[model samples]
Every structure is written in C-alpha cells, then in structure tokens.
Target: MINMKETINHYLAAWNEKTATAVKAAFQKCCTPDVTYTDRNAPTYTEEGGFVIKGIDLLTALVMGSHAKVPGRAFSLLTMPQYFDGHCHYSWGLHIPGQDEKAGWDYIVYNEQNLITRIVGFLPEQV
Candidate 1:
C-alpha cells in the first residue's frame, strides 16, 4: 500500500516551491506520466470548460503558466491528507503576495503502483 502522508507531503512540497521546474520534478517523482489533472476554477483562457490536463507535458505547461501569472505565490497544506481505497483528499491554500490566501481541496486517485494518476481540484463557489 502507498504511504499516503509521505506522498502528499512530497507533492505539496513541490508546489510550495512555487516554480514550474519544481512542479515538474515533483510530478516525475510521484505521478504517472499520463496523469490527469482537473481544476474546476481554472481561468477561461485554459482548455474548454475550465482546465483538464492530460499527460505530463500539458500538466507542466499548465503549472508553468500559473506560476508565471502569479510570481512569488506559495502553496501550503492546511490539513493532513486522508486516503482510502486508493483515493486521497487534502486541503491546501495559496499565499499570494499582497492578496488574501486562496484555499481549496483536491481529490486524488492513485494507481496500483502508488503513483498519482488523477487529481480533481475543488474551490469554494464564487458569489
């Protein structure tokens, strides 16, 4: 079985680095090459109907673009991740310079190899 906590921490640490290279390295270390990542609140400029990234290359591009948009932003885990039946859920937030923190949760599915295969992000509904 996968060590959920370790995996989550590793992934979050990569995001906390706030760099495209760091994110890509993290994915290479803990995610499948064909990982699927979905952000419900992705900017309209991304893929149709928000963002749905498939494969590592596209995932890297998406993360790079995000980092470019908000330089100096940092990510932090707000709660311990929980896992059950190959699925994990965690809450996290982004700290952007001169802006209020933005929080969200991600539901992740892991493959049998203990690598993340899919992730779906959820954010609070906009008013």
Candidate 2:
C-alpha cells in the first residue's frame, strides 16, 4: 500500500522550497509525466477559470513564473493532511520576506502507482 501521508508531505515540501528549480525537481520526482494541476487563484493571463495545467514541463514553467513574480515567497504547511477515500487535503500558508502570511488549502488525488495525478489548490475567499 502507498504511504499517502508521506507522499503528500513530500509534495508540500517541494512547494515550500526557496527556489523554483527545486519546485520543478520535486514535482518531477513525485508526479507523473502527465500530471494535472489546477490553481483556483492563478492569474487569468496564464490560465482560465480552472487554471488547469497539464504535463510536468508546463507545470514547471508555471511554477517558475510564479516564483519569478514573487522572488522571496514560499509555501508553508499549516496542518497535517487529512486523507480519505483516495483523496488528500491540507492547509498551507504563504511566507514572504516582509509580509504577512496568506493561507490556503489543496486537494490532491493520486494514481495507483503512488504518483500525484491531480492537485487543486484553493485560497481563502477574498473579503
């Protein structure tokens, strides 16, 4: 059986890394070549309403661009992931060098091979 929690934690750690290159490497290691990622709050310029990203190459570019936009920002997990029925959910917070943290959560799905197949991230609703 796959170690669901460990897998999710690895993905989160990759996301929290300081550099985009690290993020890309992490994704390549943990996700399948055709993994799909959807970020609800992604800027409209790069994606549509769903912000769907298909393939590891495209996903790496997206993450690199995001990191370029905010050079010093990184993600930090706020709570342990909750897993049930083949899905995993966890909360996270964004850290910037001189700014307050922004929080969010991600829902992830994995394939039988223990690679992440899809991930959907949701930020707190704006006031």
Candidate 3:
C-alpha cells in the first residue's frame, strides 16, 4: 500500500503549486487520469452528480484558478490523515499571512493503484 502521508502531501502539492506546468505534473503524479472532485461551495451542478469536476485536466484548471484567486496562501495539514477501506480524510488549513487560517476537510477515495480517484471537500458552516 502507498504511504498515506506521502500521498496526502503530493495531493496538497498540486494545490500549492506555483506554476501551471508544475501543478499539472503534481496532479498527474498523485491522482487518477479521470479523478472526480467536488467541494461544498461549488456553484455549478449536474443533474446526475451535483457539483463535480471530472478528469485531471479540469482539476488542474481549477487549482490554477485557485492560485489566481488566492495567491501566496498555502495549504497545510492541521491533523494527521486517517485511512480505511481505500478512503482517507484529513483536516487542513490555508495559511494566509496576517489573516485567520481557513480550516477545511478533505475526504478522498483511492483506486487499487493507490492513486486518488475522488476528492470531496467540505468547509464548516456557521450556525
């Protein structure tokens, strides 16, 4: 089995990548070619699957956009990842200089080859 911590690091590397070429390479190394991804605040949805982005290309684009939207912030693990039955979840925080950190959770599914196949991200809602 692949080391879960290493896998999680690679996953975050894609999100923290500084350039388009590097981000694409980071994602291709850690995720399946046709991986699926969705987050709680995604605005668009499909009738069948809700808000989802399928394929590495689309995922790479999404991260690139994130880099544009929030430059200089980087994600860091706030807690160790927990894994079971091809699934893993972890808490993470976005480190923004002179600003409050944003905490979130990621639940990931891995394929038999140990590549990430799906990622479900969530942000806590205020009551």
lDDT per residue for candidate 3 within 1-127, as digits (tens), equals 3677778899898989888789889888889999999985443322233578888787877777666666687898889999878999999988776778889989999977678999999865520
How would you order the candidates by TM-score, starting with the best?
3, 1, 2
Candidate 1 structure quality by residue, lDDT tens digits, 1-127 = 2587778777777666565677788878778899888876555424435578788767777766666776787778898988888899999888879888888888999977678899898864540
**lDDT tens digits by residue: candidate 2, 1-127:** 3576677767777766656678778887678889888776455425434478888777776666666677777787788888766688888888767878888888988877667889888876640
* Better model by TM-score: candidate 2 vs candidate 3: 3
Off by over 4 Å in 2: 18-21, 43-50, 125-127
Residue 5 in candidate 3, Cα distance off native in Å: 1.1
Residue 1, candidate 1: C-alpha displacement in angstroms: 8.6
TM-score (C-alpha) between model 3 and the true structure:
0.86
Stretches of candidate 3 exceeding 4 Å from the true structure: 44-50, 124-127
Deviation (Å) of 45 in candidate 3:
13
Off by over 4 Å in 1: 43-50, 124-127
| Residue 107 of model 1, lDDT score | 96
| Worst ten in a row by lDDT for model 3 | 41-50
lDDT of residue 69 for candidate 1: 72
